[model samples]
Structure formats: structure tokens, C-alpha cells
Target: MKLVFVHDGPIFEDKDGQYYEYSYHGLYERYKYLADEITFIMRVYPVEKDTKGTKLPAEIKVINVPNFKSPSSYFLKKRIAEKNIEKQIRETDYAVLRESSCAKIALKYCKKYNKPYIYECVGCIWDGLWNHSLLGKLMAPSSFIIEKKIIKNAPYVYYVTDQFLQRRYPTKGKSIGCSNVVIDKVDESVLKKRLDKISGYHVDNKIKIGTAAALDVRYKGQEYVIKAIKKLVEQGYDLEYYLAGGNRKQSTFLKDLAVSLGVEKRVIFCGSLDAAEMPHFYDSLDIYIQPSKQEGLPRSVIEAMSRGCPVLGTKIAGIPELIEQKCLFKKGSVSAVTNSIVYILHSDLEKISIYNFQKAKKYTKEILADRRRHFYDQFLEEYRY
Candidate 1:
């Protein structure tokens, strides 16, 4: 079977020369084992012109989604490009795909050509833009109409969480269940080196509360963790926080927030590290805190658990379904989030470690990959009509 994946996730450039968006690292790792021939059609933006992917597993194709931005021509050039890509899809069997942005073009072609495709929805874009102030009253209804039309057209739509399933999207066709594809193990040598570097930074017998996420705290709930960190400090606990993320500007804003709380020196902002830096950061921490009210099964929490760092997260969306522990707080409750962190910090590490270790294995890449292979095979067969 010829398997093709289309995604708009961030690209990864490591010391090794691999090329593709590494967001679904676990999924792709598993794809290595499952796909006989895999092609990843991605939007390689201007920023990634010089960068390549990690030292990825073999037998994969990195095909760039054609660019279509000419200010004088408005969207005419982009429209032409989309039409070309759509025609290409019409001529071939593109198995798996993400239903966002330009994939709509390919999806239209797939339907016209009677080719099978899977629509993967990580989140509702309309909800996302609204949450981030990118959505307006006019855009809301338009966004709804657009999403409704595209979703209804899909033969199969997959979501990383249940939010999209229990609501709109997959209005027709098979609404396949989903899971977050993160936490494929990294090179232990690279993992150890990253941790050793972090260890040399600062540690003074304080309970280390660590988090690595995109710097947007409003949606990410990193801000809530900051506020909770402040409360913890007030309670006479020596709190040391290491927040790592991609945006350097967010690091500056968080530093300011920390100063306002008088814990500026207490919070450490390790500017974005490579993908290899993730596992060690998760493992080195005493506790991992995620106060996010909005997310589709965060890879951060999964990685933290996989590395044996007890996690405290809001029981929102698919999280309560995935996390195999009592370490959850009700969404939007500041006090509850704070208390969960304290519980993990004060609890016996041994008991928590055993439970967390067993649960983390449930989200390993191998397991997720096997599930994906089954889903892809079934979807292609079921939707081929």
C-alpha cells in the first residue's frame, strides 16, 4: 500500500539531516514500522529554508506544499497552486491527511477522484482563533460554515481528542477515535547530555516544577501555572521553575510576569531547545504541571509521565480519558490546580513512580503506531467507495 501524509505542523531541524514537521514524532516513528512507502506532503515555509528534519527513520518522502503568496496577485496565485495540488491528488492514492488549511484542496480532489483519505483534526480552528482573539463575530459564523462543509465532505475524520467528536465535525462518514501521538523515546545519549547541561544551571533543594510548551500561556495554561507558582511561593515553599518553549518573546513576557510576582529570579526560561532536549527535561523534574484549560492531549504531559515525572493536569477533554491517575484538577479552578501540584510534590515518590511508569507505557510510540496502522488500513478500505 502507498501511504501519504499531509500536515502543517512545525518543522524539525536537528544535528541529523532529516526533513519534515516533527510534531507527531511518535506517530511518524510508528509510521516507519508500518508504512511500506510513506510520503509526507508538508508546507515548508520560508523560515525552514535552511533547516532539515532530524535523523529520522528511513523510507519516507518529504514533499513540499507549493507556496502561493504574491501580494500584487492577492490570492490568485495561491488559488492556482492549490488547484494544481488538488489535480495531483486526483491522479493518485493519498491515504492519510490532516484536514486543515490547504488539505481542503486535496480533500476536494480525493472526493472527486473517489480516493480514500483520513481527516485528522487536532482541534477546532474556529474555537482556536476565538480563544486567541483571532476570531470575530463575522468570522465565527463563516468559520462554522466552512468547517461544517469540509467536515461533511470527508469520508473519515479523526481527532486527537473527543472534543471534535462529541461536537461538530465528522457530521458524516466514520468518526474514528483518536489519541495524542507524542513521546517516542529519543537517543539516551542526547537525552543525558541535555539533562546534564540543565543540571549545571541552578538547583537549591527546591521542589522543581518544570514545563516545556509553546510560550502562549493563555491557551496553554502556562500562565495559570505561573500564578499557582506565586501562591506556592507565598506559602513559604522554595519554588524553582524551568519553563522551556520555542518563542523567545514569550520568555521575556513570562519573565516580566515572574518579576511582578516577585519570583523573577525563581523562574528560569531555557529558550527553545531541540526536540532531543525534551525527554531529559521531563525526566529531571520533580513534578510536571499543566494547568491548560484548552489542549488536545498534550505531548508534554505524555512525555513527562513516560519519563516518570508525576504529572498534574486539568481533567479537560481527552486528558481525563488518557491520564491513568487521580492527578487531575477540574478545569478553570485555580485552587484545584494549585492543590494538585502540591499533592504530587508532597506524596511518596515511590508509589507515584510505579503507577506513573506503568501508565506511561500505554502511550508509547509503538502502541500508537500499531493503532494507527489498523486505523489507516480500515479507513482506506471502508472509504474507497
Candidate 2:
């Protein structure tokens, strides 16, 4: 079957000439497994210098729409992009739109042509705009309206996490709960290496709390972690925060904020780690924190859990569903995070680790793939009508 995937993240051909759809490459890999042909209807852009991307699979076609990195660029280039998306969708057997700003046009064309399509609900635009800049906030209302309409009218809607999305957007058709992030069983050697390192560290030693997320999105609440760490240190606890993932420029603002909060020396900004190297990073942490103000579900928290790292996340979106209520704090709350960290420091970590690891198993690639296979079988049958 030929499937059209509509989203904004651009596909790039790296210096080595390997095709990649940025972070969405893994998701596309799963698509390549199920569909004989895949057409990605997304904004296309050039890869940055000195950087590379994950290679895409063989059975894929990329339809380059106008690349709009920000909402400011949308108005000028939207029409031409929409025309291209419409033309591409016409050739595909079905469309699967991963909810994004660029999806509005493709969704319109799909309806106009009476084409069968599914909505991949992976985020909440309303919550996403809460801490975003002026442009992001301005686009929220339209995005929210468009999202609701698509969810309501689409033949099927697949939510990345059902905890918050299904509650927020009630759909008439099939609503399958699935995560796009693929989790695999960690290697025994990797787990043992992490356990050995973890065993050597004690509570009295420098405690490491880590978060793996992009720094540019400010709403990930790195500042809150800094504040909480400052408070913890003041209470005579030796705390260090390792922020993994993000660029040097993105780290600059967080570093300045850490300095202002009097926790600069304690905060370590480890720029982005490769996928294989991420296991070692997660292994080195005593605890993982997801203080994001918005999310569909955080893949980072789940990954950390898979590595037996105790997780503390804000009670928002799908986080509460993954972590226990006792381990959760309100989003952007410094005092709440401070208290949660203190609680974690005193709690039965072994028990927490076991529980988290078991919970994470539910999101493994094998289970998710089975669910997708079932969903697609029905989708293909329905598309014929």
C-alpha cells in the first residue's frame, strides 16, 4: 500500500547522501515495514553543516512542501505548499497526518477529495502555546480549532498517549492508543554496566538528577529544575543536574538562568547524545526529571525508566499516567519539584525502579507494532469504502 505521512519535520539528505526525516526517521521506519510505498508530505530543508541525520529506509518518497520553521513564514508560502500537498495526496492510497502546523493544509485537501485519512494526535496545541512566544500563542486558537475538527471528522484518530488526548479530544471513529517512540529491550551488558555505576554512588555523595530534552523549547522547565536544585543544595544536599540533549546556543540561556539562580556550578549541560550513547547517559543518573509544561507523552521519561532510573515528572498531559502521583509535581512549580526531589531521595528507589521498568515494557516496539498492525488492517479495509 502507498501511505502519505503529513507532518512538518523536514527530511534531509545528509553529507553521506543518506535520506533522513530528522527525528521522525524511526517512525518512518515502522511505516516502511507495513506499507509497500510511503510518501512523506512534509516541509523539506537542508541539513545544517557539521551535523548528520539518521538514514531513512528504502521504500519512501518525499514530497517537499514549503519549509516554515516558524508561524511567521506560514502566510507567505502556505498556498503553494497546500497545492503541492494536495497533488501528492492524490497519488497515495491513504493519508496519515501527524498533527503539526503544516497538517492544516493537507487535512483540508484530504477532505476536499473525500480521501481517507487518520489523525495522529501526538500533542496538545493549547498547552503547547501556554509558555511559547507571541507567534506560537497567536497560532494556538486556529490550530486548536483545526485539530478538533480533524479529530471529530477523520475516519480514525490514533493518539500517541490516550491519558490526556482521548480525554481532551473525543473522536467518533476508532481511537487507538499508541506511542510513536519505539522502545526496545536494553542489552544485558548495558544494564549491568549501569547497575554497577549506580551501586557505587551513595545518597551522601553528589546526587545526580538528569533530564533529556531540548533546551530551546523553554517550556521544558529546566529553570524549575535549577530552582529546585538550588533549594535542595541550601538544605545541605549535594545535588548536580545533568541536562542532556540540545545545542550550545540553547544551553547558553539555561546556563545563564542557572547562574542567576545560584546553581551554575551544579548544572551540567551535556549537548545531544547519539542514540546508542543515550543508554550510558541514562545509566549514570540517580533520578530522571520531566518538568515539561506540555507534552503528549515524554519519550525521555519512558527511556529513563527503561534504564531503571527513578522518574519524577510534572502532573501534566500523559506524565501522571507513566509516573505515580507521589512522584509528580505541578508543572513549573519550584517548591513542588523541590519537595518531590526530597521525597525521591528518601523513597524506596529499588521498588520504584522495578515498577517503572515494568510500566515501560508496555510501550516496547513489539507491543506497539502489534497494535499498529491491527489498526492498519482495519484502516486499509475501511479505506476501500
Candidate 3:
């Protein structure tokens, strides 16, 4: 059987012809179980060097399509993109469409040709676009309506969040909630080490708080955390805010904000760390915060939890699903974030760490892989006949 996986990707090909994407490593291996051959239908971009992304295997075929920059550009190229997408859909035995403009276009062809397809609903288009900028906010309502309709009518659906996305975009067909985050293992020793670190915490010692997210996206809400850090510093708490992730331009913007807030010395930007280095990074933090204005069950939060780090996040999207109510604060509210940080500092750190470590075990690779396999198996069984 053949599978055509369509997404809004600008998957990179380096000078040596190696394919790369930030999160696509080992993905083709997982999908191979359901199909003999797989073709990826998305946008492709050429890069001079590898960008620290997962190198894709050479066997997978990539069909490049136009990447629209704006509404006008999209309208100009829509017909051409649809023609290519339709041709690919007709040629493949099965289809998988991730939520994007390309997916929306592909959906029309899927229904027209009576092809079997599944929708991989990841994030809320409305929240994503609305929080992006003024133009995105203007376009969000109609985009949400269209995506909701597409997801509702999909024959099979898979969501990353346990509850949030399903509620926002309900499907009448078969559906399953399985987070893409797959932890390698949950070690008791790691939790014990975290507990020891927590026990060593003293009021006089400088508290280190950190967030792992790209600096480019303003909606990630790192600025709010910076504001909260300023307030806390004024309250006489010695705090160091570490932000991990890269984007030089946005990093400069954040640095300027810190300087203006008079907390430049307290803010530390630890440029992007390698995947292997993240566990140690999480361990070094006194507290981890995901003060995002938007998210689709953030993998960084789960990663921090796996290391038994006490975590706080905004009450939005799938964040509430991962964090307890007491640890959650209102998104975009500096006061709420400040108060939550204070609460975590005053509360029993060991108990919170234990709870997070136990909660993270639910997303271990061995467990989630089985759930995903079962879902794919069922999908194949129904569609193959």
C-alpha cells in the first residue's frame, strides 16, 4: 500500500541532498508499518547546511509544492497547489492530512475523489493565528470555521491533546488522543536527584527559573515571564531567568525588554541546546514555566516533568491538562504568573516534583507507541478492505 502524508512543511534539503525537519526524525519508520511505500506531499526549501533537524531517510519521496506568504499570494497559487495535491491524492492508496492551508486544500480533493484519509489535528488554528498579529487576528475567525468543518467531517482523526482539541474540533468519526511526545524512560534516580536538589533549596540562594521555547514567537509569552521576574526582583527575591531556544533577532528584542525592565542582569539567554543537553538543563532550573498565550500540549513542559522538575504554566489549551490548577495562571497576566511563581516557591517542592514525574510516565515511548500502533492498526483494518 502507499501513503501520502500532506503537511504545511518547508522541509529542508541541505547542499548534500540530506532532508531535515525539526521533529520528523524516525517518523517514517513508524508509518512504514501501515504502508509499503510513503510519499510526503509538502513544501521543500533548500538550505546551505544542516539546521540541527532530524535527517530524513533517502527512501521517502518528497513532492514540493508552493508555500504561500500571504492571503493574496495564497489565492494566486491556490489552484496550482491544488492540482499537484489532487494528483498525488489520486495516485496514493491512503492519505494523512495535518492541519494547514495545504490540508484544507487536500481535504476538498480527498472528498471529491472518495479517498480514505485521516486528519491529524495538532493545534488550534484560531488561537495560533489570532495571537500571531493583527492580520492573523482578522483572519482567525473564518480559518477556525473552515478547520472545524474539515475536522468534523474527517473519516478518522488523531489529536495530540487528551481533551482540548477534541472539544474545540469534534469529529463524528473514529478518533483517538495520543500526544506526539514520547519519553525514552522515566528514571526513579532522576526524581531522587531532583528531590535532593529541592531539599537543598534555601531562601537566600538565587532562584533559577527557565523556559524552553523559540524566542521568535511573541505569543510564547516569554515577555510576561520577564515582567513577572522584574516584579519578583523588586520584592527582594534574587532570581535568574534563563530562556533556552534561538532566533537572534527575537533574542535581541527580549534582551532590550529586559534592559528596559531593569532586569537585564537577571535574564540569561542560553541559546538553543542540543537534545541530549535538555535533561540537565531542566534539572538545573529551580522552576519551569510555560507562560504561553497558545500551545498544543507543549513537549518541553512534558520533558521538564519527566525530569521531576516543578512546573507552572498558563491556563490555556492543553496546559491545564498537564499542570494542576494551583500551578496554572492566566495567560498574558504578569500578576498571575508572579503569584504562581511565589506559590510554587512556598509550597512543598518535593511533592510537586513527585507528582510531575509520575504524571510524565503516562507518556513514555513504550506506552504511547502501543496506543498509536493500535490506532493505526484499526485504521488499516477498516480502510484496506
Using Cα atoms with residue i matched to residue i, what is each candidate's TM-score against the true structure? 0.78, 0.91, 0.92
Model 3, TM vs. native: 0.92
In model 1, how many backbone clashes occur?
2
TM-score-based ranking:
3, 2, 1
Off by over 4 Å in 2: 11-13, 20-22, 69-75, 134-142, 186-199
Q: Candidate 1: which stretches are off by over 4 Å?
A: 12-20, 26-37, 46-59, 66-77, 134-153, 162-172, 182-205, 324-326, 330-336, 380-385
Residues 1-385, candidate 3, lDDT per residue (tens digit)? 8888899886878777777765554568767877889888888887422134556778799888888766778776777788899999988888889888788778888888888888999899999999999998999999999889888988899999999999999999889999878688799999999999998998668999999998888899999999999999889889999998764555998999999999999999987565677888999999999999988989899999999999999989998999788899999899999999989988998899999999999988889888999999888898895
Cα lDDT tens digits, model 2, 1-385, are 6778898876676556566543573666676654678887776656555334455676677777887555788666777787788787777767888888567777888888877888888889888985787877898888788778778877789998856898888788887988877788644454555556666766788899999887888889988999889889989999999998766776888899889988889999887665766778888889999999998888888888888788999989989889888899988889999999999988877778777877888888888889988987887777654
Instruction: Please give, for residues 1-385, the per-residue lDDT of candidate 1 as tens digits.
Output: 5566766544553445454443655455544443466766656543333333344455666556655534676488567657656655764555566755567666767777877777777766555555465434347667767877777866667777656344656557667565765655433443344345344433235778887777755666676777778898887778888887745555667778888988878788876655686766776677787776666667777777666666777776556755555788876666787788777666665556556556667776667666766776776566444
Q: What local distance difference test score does each model get?
A: 0.64, 0.80, 0.87
Candidate 2 residue pairs that clash? none
Candidate 2, run of 10 with poorest lDDT: 46-55
User: How many clashing residue pairs appear in each of the predictions shown?
Assistant: 2, 0, 0
Which one is best on TM-score?
3
